[model samples]
Target chain A: MPNDTLLETRPVPGTDKTTAVAVRTHALSKEFGGRLVLHSLDFRVEPGELVAVVGKSGCGKSTLLRLICGLEKPSSGWVEVGGERLSGLSRHARLMFQDAALLPWKSVKANVVLAAPRNGRRDRAAEDALEHVGLRDRAHEWPSILSGGQRQRVALARALASDADLLLFDEPLGALDALTRLEMQALIERLWLERRFSAILVTHDVEEAVALADRILLMDGGRVTFETVVALERPRDRASAEFTSLKEAILERILGRRS
Target chain B: MATESLSYRSRLINLAGPWLVPLGLLIAWQIFSGSGLIPRRILPSPLEVMQAGFHLTLTGEMPMHLWESFQRAIVGLMIGGSIGFVFGLLNGLVGPANVLFDSSLQMLRNIPHLAMIPLVILWFGIGEPAKLFLIEIGVFFPMYVNTIHGIRSTDPKLIEMGRIYGLSPWQLLITVVLPSALPSVLVGLRYALGIMWVTLIVAETIACTNGIGYMTMNAREFLQTDIVLVGILLYALLGKLADTITRALEAWLLRWNPAYR
Candidate 1:
């Protein structure tokens, strides 16, 4: 399998030295009212690796992210993050939803600062995060006044302000327009490159998965049906022949065609 | 620049428009009363009411009555509002509290607060306590109901987000729950203000020897229609003033809401 080869070849830059594995799930399964949603799914992500999980609707991709983030419990098996079992929300992980999910009552700065660690430098950290998202000018504005893209940027700022090692994204850009989605994907990729945090992105868009993730895992009937390591270079060109071939390969796997 | 000036003019017109009807009514009443169509004793002219208001003010009687009434309203509002806010928050957050108190409180709310005046008067006598008690009841239900509604209506998604962010229970309450509930709580406060004035008037009319209600009643006994009209006008003005202040507070507090803009 290419998995072992990719792991051996890929250099994980900025990974914390003390913890080599960022997330690990062992035979994780979840059942909702006697119906299996996720079935004994075993997965591993190295520190600083941006992994994308893709599947059709109701294929348990989101459930997996929720499980890893400690938002939901597995019916069987368990999840480990940073070598510790996740019982509830751990300070080491942060999940960003599809909706910006900014608290409408708070200003952009406050929303970000609220999630930050209660150190004296929280305000400064929030400001820096907002600056990174190109939203320092709109820090005082309410989320209600922001456009969808701006709100999402603020949400990004909130996530960035937090010192979480593992970032879980549940279709974080699924609501945006085509142009905005592309911009957000680039922004996410840039941030992931800079921060080098371990990330698990659950997305419906295969192109998005190929563009941002270092590795892509496909779920089918509640199992990890396919996985591929995208060993392509950074800032990958979508129009390039190599990028198209990799995307097509993943799509074929999802469609159950071996062409 | 031209459009900006035009919009500013339109805004000014909008501000002035609401007063036109009341001003017109006042002018018409002044002319009709001066023309002697209605007996002066029964419906005093607007000018006469203003004169009475001025005379009462000059003698300090108006201020005394106004001060007394304001003190009672404020004291009762503070006492009842705090209790209602606490209870509402508790019941909304705790399932057991809701199960224990919500239905019973809702039942109590249906019984008109004014209906308890007779029992209240007997229990507390016609002292300040009775008036305060009546006003408290008037203010409590709206605050309590709105507080509960506000707390219950907080977005579940926001709560989930808060939890995932590793917020403590207290932080979640302060950051997410309270702000979401504030708009509803403010609505309740406005309603309670309205009820407070109504209850005050009734209590003063029925028993009290002080306050604007007392002044109005005392004026009626002496057939000083002008003074009675003055007292009524004062109540209207005070009520409007309270409403305006509350609305301003709501605007300031909920400035984050796009709907408000």
Candidate 2:
């Protein structure tokens, strides 16, 4: 069994401490009451990979992210993060919601600090994370006073402050205007590149998937129906032929399924 | 120079705006009483009420009654408020506690606390305990209802986020749950302060040796209508003071809330 091998290559300390953790699900399924939201489907994300799951609303994309983060349990089958099974909330993963979901009572910096591990260095870590999102100057301000994009940036900073190996994003830019969405996409891409954390981004926007993910999974009827490898270079040019074709292909599939 | 004077006049109007209505009413009151249109016994003029207040203050009687009333209010609030808070925290956060106690408390809350005066007197025999009991009961329900409502109304998404972020149960309560519930809790506190004075007024008037209510009763028996007016005005002033303090508290604690800002 590769179980022994899984133990040996477990991102040993003093050797690539920033090495991202792998996520795997074995025939994972989730049922709410008597209704099944996610079918018995298998999925995986390689260490340091940026994978996007695109689908129509209510196709269980958000459910999958919640399950992976261990916020909700699978009704059947199981999930493994970095080789071990996810029993409760995942210790190595951070999930960001569509809404900024900030505590209105806390300042931006305090919200980020609240997520950082209780090492004595939490303040420093919060500052650094805020710096990464270019919100360091606004750290002392309340989340209420921030613009939607700025609030999302603070949320991103909060996730980064935790230093988790896996990041789960559920339509993080779904509410932003087009210009803000494009800026957030670039910001997310840059952060993913810098941190190299394993990310599973569930989005409805095909162009967003093309601009960010290394690979894309098309989900429908509570199952991943198709997969596409972008094989495109970083800082993807949306006007380029390869980028346009890939985006169009995925968009057509989603539209075709809808019809 | 013209612009500066205009700005100065606007600033003066801003300062005087809130006092305009009360000042007009006071003038009307004084003129009507001076013209003898209404007997002084029926409605004492503002000047007579002020003079009575001054005389009582010089004799140290007003301060003594004021202190008694103030002490009762604060003590009742602290004791009742703390118990209500504990019960609320327990019922709101713990399922079994809610199942066991919530219905009973809700039923008790429906019974008008002031209406229990006869029963309270029988239980505690017209002592400080009886008055305190009434005030405590009056303040308790607001605190209890609001604390639980505040806690129950906490956004579930934030709780989920807190759990994912590795917050311990206690940390979640302090950092996420409590802070979110605070605005509601303060609203409850403001309501409770108003209730505190009301309960004390009724309880003291019904049966008590000391306090503002007793002073008013004593003035009525002696046919000192001006002193009676003074007592009524004192209660109004105290109520206003309590509201102002609570408003300041809310402003300071909810400073991050844009509405408060």
Candidate 3:
């Protein structure tokens, strides 16, 4: 298998920065009732980079993603994406939740096209998005009628419908069965390759992080604890010793204490 | 064990049980009166009840009373149900406006609409307005609560999905929230219509010159037990007809839902 992992840190122009950063947090801190959730955090990502954010539950993984997505206000810092500051970009860019949040009453197609501009060719775009997600045959089915995987597919289709530049995912596949999760990972990776949306996925699965991420950003104590550039090849064989070695190395870094 | 057979038999027995008691009660009354255990006038035979019922039906008087009753019920349900639906939808969806109305609504709801009958009589003088107001009050609260409950219970995750997809707020409410709320809202409508029927009977009994309630009351004064029984039976029949129609509408509207089938 061909090694597919690629990492880039070239920042974009403007905002007095020399390199292109898809996402950046500058000395970010968040506090809730004087209890600091995230303290003095700084991070940056290049365009089209698939960064996996892994952390134990309640380690502020979700909060970090929410902050970047502008769903929550930071205590005292800023998030920037695609050279546009968080305060500046339109609401088009944001996160996909863990739950398959397809509206129960909407047909698969309608859910996907929900964000399509009124002036845009909604019918065509909706159909195309559903097709991309391999749910074309199920377009007319209500979300309530769909199986779990199919509903998640509609949610994925909904997120990608806008064809936005930045995508934040917080444990989007955490609720799925292992088999379904594997299929969804492939679907997502394929779309990432084809569309090149700068993506961040938050998950606790070390194997999943190494499997699909360009660089795994392991977080602890609300800070980036470890960054691993997955060297495994495309369609990486899970049983292969080389992949296992890489996985073990990342696992040690994720679970083991810092020197 | 014979658990499965026991369950089957239990269900069968329960289904047939209610009818059996009524039948047995009728037979005992007839036998007792015929045996002179009780006088025929004091404890009338089932035959006497049937004969009186038949007479009223044949005379067209029962039909007349029933027609009036049904007309009032239909009018009240139409006016009250529609107004309730509109206001309920408005209160549920419009947050700030809902807050503004909530306290006042809660206060007004506390005063039982039935208790206002005397005041209503004074205001409207035994006419349509008083009756309609009673029915409207009966319908409003259940619809309002169900609508608000439905709106609040919508999955927040679904709203987030709409946000990610860039759906406008209006589109989200129409395509997502409203449809998700439909089943509960329909339940409210069904209950409100039931209340409207009850309210119509009350309104008719108070000041109406027509309707089954008045006829039944009049029959009691004249000791016309048969007319009274016929009126009661007619109310049940008409109520059941209305219920069946709504059930049919519910089935038709929600045919796409597996639960409906």
Best by lDDT: 2
**Compared with the true structure, what per-residue lDDT tens digits does model 1 show for residues B172-210?**
999999999999999999999999999989989997878
Candidate 1 clashing pairs, residues 3+ apart or interchain: none
Summed backbone clashes in each candidate are: 0, 0, 5
Q: B1-261 in candidate 3: lDDT tens per residue?
A: 599999999999999997898799878878997687986545566787778778877998777877877777777777776766677777777888788987788788798889999998999899878888888788887787787778878887777666556667897888778877887888887888778888988898887788888997887788876666666767777777878887897787666567886
Model 3 steric clash total: 5
Q: Of the pair 1 and 3, which is ahead by lDDT?
A: 1
Tell me the fnat of candidate 1: 0.73
Which candidate number maximizes TM-score?
A: 2
The TM-scores of all predictions, comma-separated, are 0.93, 0.95, 0.83
The 10-residue segment of model 1 chain B with minimum total lDDT is B252-261
lDDT tens per residue, model 2, B1-261: 999999999999999999999999999999998678889989888888889999999999999999999999999999988888889899999999999999999999999998898999899999999988988899899999999999999999999999999999999999999998899889889889989999989988987889999999999999999999989999999999999999999999999998997
Per-residue lDDT tens digits of candidate 1, residues A225-255? 8889999898999999989999988888888
Residue pairs whose backbone atoms clash in candidate 3:
A10-A20, A11-A19, A11-A20, A12-A19, A12-A20
- Between candidates 1 and 2, the lDDT winner: 2
Rank candidates, DockQ, best first: 2, 1, 3
Which ten residues in a row are the worst by lDDT in model 2 chain A? A9-18
